[model samples]
Target chain A: MPQIGGAPSGDGLQAVAMAIRILEYLAEQRGGIGVTALARALGTTKSRVHRHLRTLVETGYIVQSPESEKYRVGSRLVTLGRTVAENFDLSALAREEMRALRDTLGQSVVISRVEVTGAVVLATLPGREAIEIAVKPGSILPPHCTAQGKLGLAHAEPAVRERVLLSRLDMRTPHTITSPTVLREELARILERGWAVAPSESLLGVNALAAPIFEGGGGMVGAIAILGSIQFIEAEPSALQIRHLRQAAARISAQLGDVGRDGVDSLPR
Target chain B: MPQIGGAPSGDGLQAVAMAIRILEYLAEQRGGIGVTALARALGTTKSRVHRHLRTLVETGYIVQSPESEKYRVGSRLVTLGRTVAENFDLSALAREEMRALRDTLGQSVVISRVEVTGAVVLATLPGREAIEIAVKPGSILPPHCTAQGKLGLAHAEPAVRERVLLSRLDMRTPHTITSPTVLREELARILERGWAVAPSESLLGVNALAAPIFEGGGGMVGAIAILGSIQFIEAEPSALQIRHLRQAAARISAQLGDVGRDGVDSLPR
Candidate 1:
């Protein structure tokens, strides 16, 4: 939206610039990079490049071999990649459960993570019926108009909730919430009820129900939601369906909550 | 080893330090980081930290969310991690093949990538026997003493081979190639034979046979080798064993060679 970078903010900015230049150079080369090569490529002095590389090594952005001293990307960078890619999203952990939920309800299932801008669907499973709504993975949905979005907004921390609602609520369909007051009322109900239902809010004749996915750290991470034509799924779910959906969501949340604490994705030796 | 980064050498060094400091701070936060928070954590001025943040975002060392403008690690760092972790090693892709190779031969299998200094074993599958040789993943093997190491050296680019040969050839056992001339002769023979074997060079009564793993890019990325006690495998492989090992290595090399070109793990959709 607004211009973010480019102005010289301080001495630290120059350091950040050089460090990034080195990384950009390293990214181009698949093999290990040397200080001389980086300096030559960036049109700088070798000694200068070497000093920067040493600092990068200390911070774990650049790793140097014990014998060769050749630098490559560090394991920490990979750790960060996993963070950005998943962002506390638990689709891989909830994949099987999402499929099971879809089969049980015979409705389309969607798991989405609420981002600063909007809700991003991480994964989805189709309904038992041949005809089903297919939400592409990575597709974005308005926070005020979908079951997954409602669950996300409902469970988000107050700061995030307030910021997300600051913008005008563009209606996706006739049933979509256009008033901040009404949406806030629904969110309160969702927090108390532990789930949210949006009937024909995203698209006409479509209804969706969702449950919040929580992390072990006591934060709402995403949502496990199911939607279908009003003929199959209405605004409210059957007691049994609600239990199954919430149970699956809760189970996935529990499993993911212990990720870093229990070493869920750590190296297996 | 030499007290790497506490002392800065030049103006460029300061840039490197600031960039790395930002990365280290970013690693500590799971959510998003703003310029103001980063400056406070590092005890630097906010304007300076903002400048550094801009450089990181530009180089992909840090990512800025369009909606939040909060910085985190970018996707490119993940790409770099894959390169450093498994770029030259096919163990993960060849996992099933390695298992099959072991099952068929009833011996332990080791996969290693040969770097400038030595060979680093990426993965291993224990043999069928109760007393199978155990080679830990990430174990380093001397180039002069291992079948995988020799295979790597024999096929390496001339510059690397020359450099490795220049290093002292320490004798591991009486059978190890302590003389550079003799090792060169064996390497020449290995080039002709498409494989290499080292008998009792590493241990008193163990033998290993290795074949070079070739990527689609025409580089010998690593070696796939099988080893066991002298009683089971002996000093050299039988023609049948050689054929099986080569085929397995070739299959894995083919599968992984297209990674950089095909863009397989770029980002999960």
Candidate 2:
């Protein structure tokens, strides 16, 4: 393997550095990026940028717009990202369970995983014959406010939780919890109860319930969440649905080889 | 911004070259790459590779798998890749219509676009119920056997189609049309009817119907495909569903600013 971003010692290392710089610049830009603008942003000559762009193009890591002479990242990168997601296998394992949950709860069901930096929605199965909520795969939501985010944070290691608490948390809605103390308390409660709920926190008029999915190593690898419009979610008479959600999560966790704490070690593969 | 592959005149270009070399090596592997293996593969020192890997990690373009200590592409790259996909926006415009088709036909629906080298599935909506046949987003199917592939080839330039015809087309299933003459005739029929079908051609017991999504500039940007198990699709004997699929494709193409027989002036804002 060639060095990715080390100091320019050789041609290979230099190429990798340039590619990283180019990707970083493109990531910062919300709209499409042009060659000249990218070159300017990196403080490099346009001709040089063009060559790197060509290499990125051939590799399907980046694409050039036919309408505008701009370059953007390509779908191949998404395929690669999905490979990281494959290890979790939450989608495949929970596909039927997610569908069953959505059918039973009549809400959007989402499976989310804790990544190195943030939480990402791995899969979403919308409710039957309902107003659809488009939760595309790869959509990232902040851990402090979302139900799955809270569940994941509640189950994360202390050091990881502390880091999250200290990091800047974006408030997507007015009801979003911004204070670290409040979030910490909420996470603790969620951990104790083995479930979490967020009512119009991340997005107005959307309520969500989530429970953690544990990996074989006793780590919370992901969460199964059910989301619905506040009107629908709140209209339920009792917390029975919440209980059901927890049961569903537990079943999924069991499927993932999480036998209760007492029997987990003795369970056969 | 930086030169990626070509020989650089200075240190900056040298860095770009190194990155490209590393990327090329990774591309060849088609699997997660280890630092030591990559170092040997690139004939570079491990420390140098480690440094470059660190830089790639910092940029969020590549991630080190905790399980294997091997490097794979990262989700950030997928975020950037999705930006490029958003730039295309053909799928975004067609999403609603695809949903409608899925509802109407009760089949998995796919929207695909042609790239310079191959065709890529831009978006896919699973059927109303759990179906065995589900084409994933970013799944690249062969251009010769799939219904969408045939639609794409039918509308492509004659010379391009000829080139494809000359190449060997792998038979994915026993029913796949591998004969060049048969494929050419099928392509002709597709061009004439503006639609194509594959009855258990790509996969056993799976069938697909596709129609080209063409722009006003006479460019066939993509296709709308409805796929299902042969049993269900054959049960509904109606050209109306096929027309609906074609009409949906046309609506999407129009949304891409296609005005039939006139050049694509501008996409719908």
Candidate 3:
């Protein structure tokens, strides 16, 4: 085992990065992906990607389909991901709250960690309906587009907010707020109201309402949101939806040892 | 991106392997691990492991505790693992079957992918009882010492069986069959009876009975098992338990296009 010194030959680190990227891309794809397509997506050559894929296949991180000769994520890797999520205190604690929210609202509930880039979904419970809005856990919701994302951005640190403002905000839908000034103003409104809503922004007909979850030190660590079709989770959310969403967020934050009041105490009983 | 030629410098591949191993190890540990402990576990120096840990932490694959300086799996990696598992058809398809088995037997039901080494759990459903036998998905069962593992071995290819026979069988408990000759006889019996049980073998007070699941072309792809306390899932299982387990396995196999019968067709109602 030679030392991986900080030299160009230290491409060992690069290989590790490339392997993870490949697994991420495969995880996102519902269908199997070929070496060529993966190489293109990764901005690397076919052979390089091929070698990495081969190693991943051999290690049981990704499995190559016998019929299609394409690769997909393997069960071993899935187990690894699940184990990580299961071990996290945030996800474990939030799930019971999320289930309760789902039961009361009959709509899908999501809990997301507020990251610099956006809100990363940690857990989700599906709505109790024939037609439900379901977001995959581990998917990122962009800062400019989603209710969770917007609430996360509004509560995020100044530097994090500046980063999102400086970066290009790709329009997910026609309703997505791309202007930094407008988003800044929207963030102010969310702060004042103690909740956030993104109607037909991230997707054409989907809408969500979010409230912030704080940790012990009064830091907004995450958000709890309810999502559905615009028809259900309207542009102006129903009184019951807002009430339960705020209560759920507050409950989770309290369990995490946060004593901060996000105006939940002021809400009409 | 330099082409990693097959020299010792190709430790790029080694780095990738090391990163994955670290993740797998972290996923297993409930508490955060220190750099020294991880290095010791990997049989490497602290510095080498530290560098890998830094890369992982930077990439959100692992996180280091600011208070304790110990490391644990991060949410991003959990999401990746879950995404991979959700993308797999086997886990999705078998979940419904596992739920049904749990309903019928009131014992925890597990579905595992049969590998040369053992059975790797893909999905599991908790039993209806207050004291349930719950096995985590993604954990591996040893071929010589568990019900699912034995059923997998009984139906595996000859080369695979030989490989297991040649490997050292560690004694998990007093009842675990460490002798290859004894295990060989047990495998033959499982083949004849079309089911397998490991009572007080893997764990002292637990037992499991398993039947094989097959994919197209009559190949054994996995197994479905009902596990509980030894009091419930006895060494000599009830006829109802055997019947339901076999039926569930057959139903899943049929869905996968496997038409072969392991005496399932001849079982009395």
Candidate 4:
């Protein structure tokens, strides 16, 4: 049987666990969600979730969206985020790995953070002959198209994954995943295979491969993507290329204190 | 009567409220704290605080330092922080205000975020002939010295304020606040005045004035600083300079949804 409360079944206080999960769910929604949808996703009753939401919102861990009439992650979390990122140097931790992937794979390597709104590039290292050398640090990518975006979606919590599937899969290119059925299938493939690749999905003639970076506790902190020409990166990367990319991703994740494992089965997924 | 459980006296769940306050206290520490210190700061029993800390640590909201055995803000907060920041664009929101302040004052303007460690430049805009245009965005300033740093400290929680004063005030320059007693006195004055000034505390002949930026909820999101030579910004800003600086700060705080009031009586102090 599932645990009584919504949080993971453990020795910890159920109320606290539920509160954190509520914050996590709000974050995944990016846009926010009403209490009904939130409770349904969390596998708890509406009243229980409402109690937790009240506490979360009161502490500024979550905010009620005026337009959507749903709870979204709030600015207090943003304040804590800056404190933790600067304290731990999560972006700086990803730097050496990005440079290595760029040099070894001969493709531009980018570290993009997975946020509530979308996958935004945190930093990028250009490779030899890389076209998109100037990828701005904060550019957002469509989840249905880019390798980094897919990597994030594939590892998202079930509620979030379902919601994203139920939402619009914007067609960035002909190859982008536009159907829920197709996208679900691709996400399962990403979980099983440990990497995602896109050939002209985000843009024509551009190809990329990405692997997830996990925090020590299991959540996917971000993803490292290797970008290059369609001819170079190809429809599916070579075995050697995949091996190098995975190594670079694992190294960066290690710096961030991830469990040193990239497989979804071993992570928060 | 005080709330039986933990947390501020309110109509909400005491456990949840206490848990959130514990995280806030950790953030103010900008590092970690032992259970006793945390309990003492929150005015809760050690056992009660420990129970909450266990829940927080288990959820990755807080982590224990292996060496000091103190509980500190964890990576999960970093995760939530990222979700809040990019989702809300607190830094981006401050960027627009920086330009206006610079344009109006004819002095270089800067937006600096206050974190556990110190005050950091979040964004900057140049004046008509500002030579310090290259003030790196992430530069950290001595907390006991800069106008931005004092603005942050003046509004920090009592526990955090005491801790910062307890530490050695590094001598960045002869005029730096090197004495705990004097710095404490200055912080009280800053809280009363709603601003701070540093004449060569960071570098010789460089003068600056700063005001705190607040969110709608009365939290200090960041601070705005106007920098120039002794002739331009002045050791003590003229009534006109103070007026423009305060207006620019209030406008940015409004953008961030601060309550539009900055008296210490209304803020954390």
Candidate 5:
């Protein structure tokens, strides 16, 4: 028999587990979902699901639509979710991987979320080198000049590319690609190569090599990059650097539910 | 006196409640928080708190720091939070207020989140008028022109304001504000007056009046705006219109935990 209410079959926190599953399912759904539907989907009795739904509604984790009388994720849950996303989660997920990347390459690692205006820095790990690129968690990297930005552009939807290209590409440095045609060509190559690089583009003496991180179902969620002085990293990045970067990205992607075959073993030599 | 489990007390979902409290507390905290500390904070025994933490970590809602062994929110929680924010919560919170505003004014009402690039439209209620404003969800309002954008700029941090002003402000219409000095002056006025208006700025013959929506700590979370033909929503809106819009914003803000004295009752006549 299935365990219920600390029945000693297992940890007996099955009620909490059920409640979380209901929430996760609700988050995935579009509109109001009724108790019967939720019960059927979760493979539980209607009464058990109903009790949990009532508790959730009381706690403001979910709300009942006034008109439909069906349930949906509520404001309090959304607020908690926002707090986790804003303060902890993404950077937390990348911390170990970032540390590993930095240790392997002796280069500063930067993680960025692909936002509308630019690739916004989410986290950064300092390198072993004395002279390091000074990028923080909130820095916005220009699309035409940074490795992460270019990778984001390469994987972004067509409309996103159109919007970025339509805007005036500000020249951050002498080597920055301000022309739409040049940037477009670079983005195309980056897409094909599965990685990106920007040498002396955003900063005169800084270079970065990046690869795309994917969420489940193959959507590009963000970019992971290694930052260093041009003395070590060049416009043409070393194969070792590219491979390690891609591998790191792939591992993070796997943890994020992207279990596709295009992982480390599938990389082209 | 404190309820624990399904004893002769209210609701009897104390275990679930305690689990949620732990998650919420962890979300509010930075870095890892220990079990002893959490137990102390919750006024519960160490063993009881530990059980819930184990279940939470196993479910991936939170994780134990490998080195510190303290707990924090995990990737799953973050992913769920992003899903809720991107798909439902803010719009859901504004729906009732938006509907009320539209019913009162017969003008289209738009809700927008202040993002890095611009004020992003989260939801819209079509006006009662036959010829309604055509703005929809996901539309990006240009910072120099739209009422929502102006209101967002007024409440934004100094760095955010500087970034928008430093960028080339493309004029959408002849009346669109392009000069940084002019926009800066307008923003100052908006901040002082507690609202914003843009007439024939983003689009000719189109106008919008907007008010900021504040969160718990009075941080401007987003904006609520009324959109219509310039003939209806004039550059100088009617007092009736302004009061209604501000009231709607206030009520929504109040629901979001901004229970300060500066609410509907405190508005200037």
Candidate 6:
């Protein structure tokens, strides 16, 4: 028999798990899901799923169609999501800075944050030209591969970094950094140099440079990166552009209340 | 005593409600919330809240600082929200058409959708000039006070439109369509004319014109609108710009699989 609230039995704890599972399933489906389908997917009885559905509907986390009785993720979640996205102070502070970077460097600029599980693209400003690389906001990049991920890992606490290294790093490209020892050493070098670079590491022919943004409390809040075609970024002398990106990252860090001395020594050679 | 899981008494159901309550509380708090504060706000026992917190942590819906034990909404939600925002066909179709309209009329473009509880701005493209009025994506607007809202209501199902009329109409400015009867009549005219216009409806001296984006099925998905200072929109000969806006809206509607040839005769005078 399945564990029905045995060791997991607590004050409404099971309900919370069910709700999250329901939301996750809805999120995965994208389209609205019917009650029966949801129940089958969750491996629960229809009555149990129906009870949870009613709660979700009443709470505005999911909406039930009047005609079809299908349930979809609700608009309240969108409102809540907006609030959370805006909570990353780095996004707000980097907005104008990223725009300037795009204008100056003529390349797409993206700001990303490292959460416990992975790295999420927070904001992206496309380059002025129509043919530039586009990294849509909200795209998740593997923590062991992308430039932003390396930058984030470089700044993460030692324990957290080790845990991440221990996890499987699914290689996305032929050039992706896969070995944990190599990745660990690369992260160390990133920390020492104050920036990270991914040359065709995440996607082939896409070059990216990233620097970490620190909060006032000294924790790395996120990373600011500039991305473009290898042909463009490599062919052009990018010392000035790299300096501008670093300066912009520093400004964002300052806005997050990071008042550290200018760490010019951190820029990757 | 509160009605604790009055209708849905299953353990899983209750757990879902508690987790939603916790998220709602965190959203309101903006900054990371402590377990004690969340429990007090949610009017539940600390131990119960802690259990929910642990579940959220495991599911990646939330994360707590190792040092502080303070919890914040997780990046998983951000990734999910981005998917929703991007996959919103209405917004995607509107963005390209809005860019075209902005280029043609040199006015800011906005696409809005009516949510269950409120109106949401889904996408926005600012005009080339600094004199234009711009709405940011994810901004909320009152239904009875914006042109996009009026267009949405004009094209909504009869029952929903009636409910909106029965609801309170928040008066944002003197020009807001506040009276239910008058607003209903206005919607009728807009339906007849195939478009809607609001002169200083939500903001003083800001004029807006919008057309609905019809889905393949009969229902309206969203509305695309152009906003400008009254003096600017009126100063130009409006027939050409209005024609362009209608054509742009039609293009987006067609992209959404709206094959109806009812034409621009449905616009309001």
Shares of reference contacts reproduced by the candidates, in order, are 0.31, 0.18, 0.39, 0.42, 0.29, 0.26
Give RMSD (Å) of candidate 3 vs. truth: 16.3
Clashing pairs for model 3 are A81-B81
**Model 3 residue B217 lDDT score:** 45
Model 4 stretches astray by more than 4 angstroms: A1-22, A25-54, A63-75, A78-269, B1-9, B12-78, B82-88, B130-134, B262-269
The iRMS of model 1 comes to: 10.7
> How good is the docking of model 4, as DockQ?
0.20
Candidate no. 3 TM-score: 0.43
For residues A1-269, what per-residue lDDT tens digits would candidate 3 score against the true structure? 22223545433377777888888888878767889998999899999999887777656666654545677666566556656655656777678888888898898888888766689998888889897679898899888889888888887768769888879998888899999999999999998889999999988999999999875445676899988999899999999888888988887766554555556754322
**Pairs of residues at least 3 apart in sequence or in different chains that clash in candidate 5:** none
How does residue B75 of candidate 4 score in lDDT?
62
What DockQ, between 0 and 1, does each candidate earn?
0.12, 0.10, 0.17, 0.20, 0.17, 0.13
Candidates 1 and 6, the one with greater lDDT:
6
lDDT of 2 by residue, B1-269 (tens): 53234533533344455665665455334446788989998888998777776766655455554444677544344344444444556677688998888888888899888754556988888887664588888888777888888887887668778988889888899989899899999899888777788887888888888877764334676888888888866523357766677778766765543445523323232
lDDT (C-alpha) at residue A264 in model 2: 22
Ranking by TM-score: 5, 4, 6, 3, 2, 1
Query: What is every candidate's alpha-carbon RMSD to the true fold?
Result: 18.5, 15.0, 16.3, 11.2, 10.1, 15.0
* lDDT, candidates in the order shown: 0.71, 0.70, 0.79, 0.74, 0.79, 0.72
Q: Best candidate, DockQ-wise?
A: 4
Off by over 4 Å in 3: A1-12, A90-269, B1-12, B90-269
What is the C-alpha lDDT profile of model 5 across B72-141, one tens digit per residue?
7664666676566556556787899999899999999999987656799998989988887868788898
Give the local distance difference test score of model 6: 0.72
Worst 10 residues of 1 chain A by lDDT: A260-269
Instruction: Kindly report the root-mean-square deviation of model 2 from the true structure over all alpha carbons.
Output: 15.0
C-alpha positional error of residue B106 in candidate 1 after TM-score superposition, expressed in Å: 12
CA shift of A199, model 5, Å: 8.1
Q: Which candidate should be chosen as best, given TM-score against the real structure?
A: 5
Tens digit per residue, CA lDDT, model 4, B1-269:
32113535683667778887887777756445788888898998999988887777667776554334666665678766665554554467677767877777788888888876678887788788736533678898667888988888888888788898898777877877788899899989988888899888887788889988876457786888888887877777898788778877877665543445443222221
